[model samples]
Target chain A: MKIQLALDRLTIEQAVAVTRPVSPYIDWIEVGTSLIKEFGMDSVRALRNAYPDHVIVADMKTFDNAVYEFEMCFSAGADIATVMGAAPLVTIEACMNTAAKAGKKVMIDLLHTSEEQLEALQMYSDAIFCLHVSKDQQEMQGSTQGTEGFYVPPSLSGEGRKLAFAGGITVDMAQALTRIYPHVMIIGSAITKAKDPAAAAKTFYQLKKE
Target chain B: MKIQLALDRLTIEQAVAVTRPVSPYIDWIEVGTSLIKEFGMDSVRALRNAYPDHVIVADMKTFDNAVYEFEMCFSAGADIATVMGAAPLVTIEACMNTAAKAGKKVMIDLLHTSEEQLEALQMYSDAIFCLHVSKDQQEMQGSTQGTEGFYVPPSLSGEGRKLAFAGGITVDMAQALTRIYPHVMIIGSAITKAKDPAAAAKTFYQLKKE
Candidate 1:
C-alpha cells in the first residue's frame, strides 16, 4: 500500500514546497482537480519537474475527449491520469489507450457510478479503480452528513480491483482503510487542510504502516 | 432553439477570434471543456472578455468539490459552469448553491449515467441536464460511428431533464434535434471540424429556421 499524497487547493509553488518534505514519504503525488482547473497543464509540468522520481497523478476526472485529455497530461509529465468511470466505456477505452501509448497508468474514478457500470468495466485489469467521496459536496444536504470519510466495504473489496480511496479521511479512517481495504487509499483535507500537513501525513503514514 | 458553439482544440487567440465572429450567429459560446483544461481558469476570463455581451459557459465539468470550482469559474467571468451528473447529489446541490450565490447557472453534464441516477437527480430543476456524448471516444467508436453531429434522446428523458446534446452531430441530426427536442442541443465537431465551420453552423441555424 504505497501512499499517494494529493495536493488540493495548493498553488504550483506551494504544491512543490509541500511535497519536498513529504515526497520521500509519498509513493505518488496527485495534482488535484482543483489545481488542474486553477493552473491548467502547467500544474502537471511543474509537479513532474519537481518530483522527477515520484509518480505524478493529474486528477483530471476527465468526462469527455478522454484521448485528448490523457495525452495532454501524459505529455506534460503525468505518470498517471484519471478518467471518470461514469464516462462511457468508449471514453474509458480511449483513456486506457492513451495511457498505454504513453507508458502511463490510468486511474478510473468511481465518483457516482452504478454497480452495473462497475460490472461492465471490470475488464480494466491494469487500471487503478478509485472510490472517491466529493469533498466539495459531501454532506451538503442528506448524502452522508458529518462523516469524516466514506467506508464502502462492498466497493472497496473488488474481485480484482486495484483499489484507491480518496476523500476527507481522518486518522481513524486511514487505519481502518489500511487494515481492511488492502489497497492504496488517498486523503485530501485531512492532510492538505491541516494546520500541520507534514505531521498529519506522517501520522497517516505511520498508522497505515506504509 | 439556440445555437451553442464549442470552441474546442483551438489556441486561446484563435478561440477569441472565432468566438467574436460566431457570437452573433450563436446564442452561447461554450468555452469547451478542452479549452478549460488546456488553459485553466484564464480560459473563462479571456472568453468572457472577448464576448462581453454573449453568455459564456465554461465547461468545468467538476466531479468533486463543487463550491471551490464553481466559485473559481464564476469569479473568473463565466455566466455558467458545468457540474457532472455523475457527481454526488450533494455535489450537485453544492454547485447549485454556489451558482445561486454567484448569480449564475449550473449545467449538469449527464455523460455516462444510468437512467436511475438521472431520475434520482431530476430535482435540480434549474440545472440544464445535458445528454452529452464524449467528444473523442463516442465519435470514433464503432457503436456511434457515422452517427455524429445530432441529438438522440437518452434511454430515459424524465421531467426537469432540460436537454443539451453533443457527440459528432450531422446536418440531418442537427435538423432533427432542433425539431424534436424541446431544449438546448449542443453540436460540436460535426460543425466545428467541418471544412467551413461558420457555414456549417449556418446550416444548423438554417435547419432550425425551417
Candidate 2:
C-alpha cells in the first residue's frame, strides 16, 4: 500500500517546509481541497516545484465543471485529480476522459454517493475509487479505524482496480487496514500535525512492510 | 425578482470590466465556482472592492470543511456564499450558523440533490435555495427554458423563503419565469457570452418589470 500525505490549511511555504522532512516515507502528496481553494492552482504549482519526484494529488472535490477542473489540475502539474462520485455521471466521465487524454489519473470521492450511484460508477475500472468519510462526519461520528464497514463492490474488485481509503486515519490502524489491501491510504492530521511528522510517516510506512 | 449576473471563465480584471457595463441591470454579482477555484479568495475580494455596494455572491459550491469555507468567503467580502445542498446536514448547518453569526447569507445549490436531502434542508428558511442545472447537464440535456418541470416542495413554499433558479436562462424565458416568481434569476452565458452583454441583461431586467 502507498501512503499519501494530505496537505491542508497551510500556506505553500509551510507545506513545503513540513513535507521535506517526511518526503522519503510518503509515496504521494495530496494538495487538499481547502489548500486549493485558499491558494488556487499556485499551491499545486508550488508543491510540484518543491517535490519534483513525488506523485501529487490535487484534491479538488470537484462537483461540477469536471473537464475544466481536471484540466486545470493537470496543467498545474498534478499527476492525479479528484472528482466527487456524487457528481453527475457525465461529469465523472468527463474527468475520466480528460485524465485519459492527459495520461493522468482521477480519483472518485464517494463522500455522500448512494448505492445506486456506486453501481453506475463501476464501469470506470481505471479510476481510483476513494471510500472517503467527510471530515465533518469524522468529527461527528469518530474514527472508522480504517475498515469498520468496508465492502468492495464486485466490479471494482477486479485486478488493477485501485481503491483508496481516507478520513481520520491513524498510524495504529495501518497494519490491520493493509489486510483489506487498499492501493492508497490518505493520512492527514496524523502526520501533518504530529510533532515528529517524519517519524510518524516512517512508522506508518514501516507498518505496511510488517 | 432580482437579476444576478454570473461571471465565470474570465480573469479578475476581465470580470470587473465586463460587469461595469451591466451593473445597473444586475442586482447580484456572482463570482462563479470556476472563477473562485482559479483565482481563490482574491477573486471575491477584487469584486467586492470594485462593486462595494453590489451584492456579491461567491459560488464556493462548498461540499466539506463547511465552517472554514464559509468563513473564508465571508471574510473575503462576499455578501453571500453558496454551499452544496447534497452536503451532510451538519455541513449545511455549519454554513447556516456561520452565515448567521456574520450577518451574511448562504445559498444552497440544489444541483443533483436527492429528494430526501431537499426535504431535510427545508428547515433553513432564510437560506436561498438555488435550483441549478449544471453547464454539463445543460449541454447534455438541452435548455430547461426556465421552468419545464418546476415543483416547489410544500415546506419551501412558505412566505419569505427565497428561491433562485438558474441554467440556460434566456430573455424570452424571463417573462414566463417571472410568473413563477423566483427571488433571483442567475443568468450566465446568456449575458456573459452575448454580443452585447449589457443589452442582454437590460432585456431580462426589463421583462421582469413588464
Candidate 3:
C-alpha cells in the first residue's frame, strides 16, 4: 500500500513548507479540493514545479465540463485529477479518455454514488474508484475496511480499477488499511493538521515500510 | 424575474471590467465557480468592492463547513453565495444561518439532486433553489424550451423558496425562462461568452424588465 498525504486547510505557502519534509517519505501529495478552488490550476502547476518527480494529485471534485476540467487540471500538471462518481457516466467516460490521452490518472469520488450506479459504471473507463465518506458524517469507522470504510472491502477484482479511500483517515486507520487492502491510503487531517506533519507522515510511511 | 450575469472564465480584471458596463442593468453579478476557485474569498472581495451598489454573488459552492464557507464569502461582501444541493441538509441549514446573520442570501445549485432531496429542504432557508444543469452534460438541450429541454421548468413551492435556472443560458433561452417562470433566471455563457457581453447582458435584463 502507498501513502498519499492530503494537504488541506494550510495556506499554499504553509502546504509547500510542510510538503518539503514529508515528500521524501510519502508517495502522493494531494492538492486538496479546498486548495484547488482556493488557488485554481496555477497551484497544481506550482506543486508540480515544486516537486517535479512526485505525483501531484489535484482534488478538483469536478462535476461539469469533464473534458475541459480534466484537461485543464492535467495540463496544469497534475499527475492525477478527480471526477465525482456522482457525475454522469458520460462525464466520467469523458474524463477517463482525457486522462488516458494525457497519460495521467483519474479518480472517481463516490461520495454519494448509489450502488446501482456503481454497478453500471463497472464497464466505464478503468479509473481508480474511491469510496469517500462525506466529511460532514464525522468520525468514520476505522475497522470498516477499504479507504473510508464506506464501501465493501477489498475483493480486488472485476473492474481492474485501483482502490483509494479518503474522508477522515487517521494514522492507525491508514496502518490498518496498509495491512489488508493493497490499495493506496489517503490521509488528510491526520497529517496536514498534525503538530509535526513530517513526523506524522513518517508514521504512515513507516507502516508501509513494515 | 431577475437577471443574474455569471462572470466565469475571466481574470478579476476582466470580470470587474465586464461587470462595470452591465451592472447598471443587471440585477445580480455572479463571480462564477471558476473565478471563485481561481481567486478565493478575495474574488468576492474584489467584485464586491468593484460593484458596491450591485448584488455581488460569490459562487462558493459550499459542500462542507457550510457556515464557515458562507461566512467567509459574506465577510468578503457577497450579497449571496451558492451551496450545492447535493450537500447535507445540515450543511444547507448552516448556510441559512450565515445568510440570515450576514443579511445576505444562499442559492442552492440543484445540479444533480433528486426530487426526494429537494422535497426534504422545505424549511429553514427560503434560498434561491437553482435548477442547475451542468455545462459538461453535453446532452444538448438545443436553443429553447421547446428545443429538447434537459429538465422541465423547475417547480418552486414549499416555504416559498425562490427558483433560478442555469446551464447554457442564452438570450433566447433566458427569454424562454422569463416567459415560463416568474423566477430568478441565471444566465452564464449567454452573457459571458457573447461577442458583446454587455449587450448580451442588456438583452437578458430587457427580458427581465418585461
Candidate 4:
C-alpha cells in the first residue's frame, strides 16, 4: 500500500513546511479539503511546485459540476482529485471523463454512500474508490478506528479495483491495514497534526514495508 | 418569497460588479460553490465587505468535517452556509449546532439525497432546507427545467419550514414557482450570466412582487 499524506487545516506555507520532511517517506500528497477551502487552487499549485515528482491529490470532495471542478483541479496540477460518490452518477461520469481526457485520476469518495449507490459505480472501473470516514466521526470515536467499520462491497473488491482508505490513520493501524492492502492508505491528522510529522510518516512508511 | 442571486464561475471582482445592481432586487447573495472553490473564503469576505447589509451565503456544500467548514464559512462573514443533506446525520447535526452557536443559518442542500434520508432531516426544521438540482443535471437538461421534477417531502414541508429552491431558475419559471412559493428562489446564470443582469433582476423582482 502506498502511503498518502493528507494536509488539512493548514496554510499553504505550513502545509509545504510539514510535507517537505515527510515527502521522502510518503508516496502521495493530498491538498486536503480544508486547505482548498482556505486557500483555493493556489494550495494545489503550491504543493505541485514544491514537490515536482510527488503525486498531488486535491480533496475537492466535489458533489456537483464535476467536469468544471475536475478540469480546474487537474489544470491546477492535481494528479488526482476526488468527487463524492454521493454525487449523481452523471457527475461521477463527468469527473471520470474529465480525468481521462486530462490523463489524470479521479478518486470517488464513498462517504455516506449506500450499498445501492455503490452498485451503480462499478462501470467506472478506471477510477479510484475511497472508503472514507468523516473527520467528525473520527473525533467522536477518538482515533481512526472508524476504518474498521468499513464495509467493502463484494462487487467492488474482487479484481482490478483501486481502493483507498482515509481518516486519522496511525502507525499501529498501518500494520493491520497492510494485510488488506488498499491501493492507498490516506493518513491525515495522525501525521499532519503530529508533533513530529516526519517521524510519524517514517513510522508509517516503515510499517507499510513490513 | 425572497430572491437569491447565486454568483458563480466569476472572479471576486466580476461577482461584485454583477451583483451590485442586482442586489437591490435580491434578498440573499450566494458566494457560489464555484466561486468558493476558485477564490476560497476570500470570496465570502469580499462579498460581505462589499455588501455589509446583504445576507451573504457561502455555498460551502460541506459533506465532511461540518464543524470546521461551517465555522470557517461563518467566521468569514457569511450569514448562511450550506451543508449537504447527503452528509451523515451526525455531520448535519454538527453543522446545525455550529450555525446555532454562530447565530447564523445553515441551508441543508438536498442534492442526490434519498427520500429515506430526507425523513431523517425533519428534526433540523430550524435549518433552511434547499431543494437543489445539481448544476450538472441542469446543464445536461439544457436549462433549469430540472426544478420542475422537484419532489418536496411532505414531512419536510409545512408551516414554519424554511425551504429554498435553486438551479437555473428563469423569469418564466418564476411565475409558475411563485404559487408553490419557496422561501428563497435562487437564480444564478439567469441573472449573473444575462447580458442585462440589472434588467433580469428587476424583472424577477417585479414578478416576485406580483
Q: Best candidate, DockQ-wise? A: 4
Tens digit per residue, CA lDDT, model 1, A1-210: 867888887788998887776665678889998898988899999999888998889999887788888888888899999988888788888899989988999998887777878887778889998877667544454242123434554644567668887766677777767655546767666776778878878887786654
Q: What is each predicted model's overall lDDT from 0 to 1?
A: 0.77, 0.87, 0.73, 0.87
Q: lDDT, candidate 2, residue B198? A: 88
For candidate 3, write residues A48-134 as lDDT tens digits.
888898898988877666776787788888989888777666678788888999999988877766665678666654678776765
Error of 2 at B136 (Å): 0.6
- Candidate 3 runs further than 4 Å off: A139-150, A153-159, B138-155
Mark the regions of model 2 whose C-alpha exceeds 4 Å error after superposition.
Answer: A143-159, B143-149, B153-155
The positional error of residue B131 in candidate 4, measured at the CA in angstroms, is 0.8
lDDT of 2 by residue, B1-210 (tens): 889999888889999999998999989999988888777888999999999989999999988888889898899999999999988888898899989999999999998888888889998988999988797787766646454446676767788889998878887666678888889999998898999988998899887787
Fnat for each model: 0.79, 0.51, 0.40, 0.63
Compared with the true structure, what per-residue lDDT tens digits does model 4 show for residues B125-173?
Answer: 7889998878998776554534354567898868889988887788877
Instruction: Judging by lDDT against the true structure, name the best candidate.
Output: 2
User: Could you arrange the candidates by DockQ from highest to lowest?
Assistant: 4, 2, 1, 3
Off by over 4 Å in 4: A141-143, A146-150, B142-150
Which residue pairs show collisions in model 4?
none
Error of 3 at A134 (Å): 2.8
TM-score of each: 0.89, 0.96, 0.88, 0.97
Going through the candidates in order, their DockQ values are 0.66, 0.69, 0.45, 0.74
Tens digits of per-residue lDDT, candidate 3, B32-68, equal 8777666666677888888888888788777665665
Instruction: Encode model 2's per-residue lDDT on A1-210: one tens digit a residue.
Output: 889999988888999989999999999999988888877888899999999999999999888888888898899999999999888887898899999999999999988888888899998988899988788787765646454446676756778889998888887666667878789999999999999998999998997787
- In candidate 1 the C-alpha lDDT for residue A144 amounts to 26
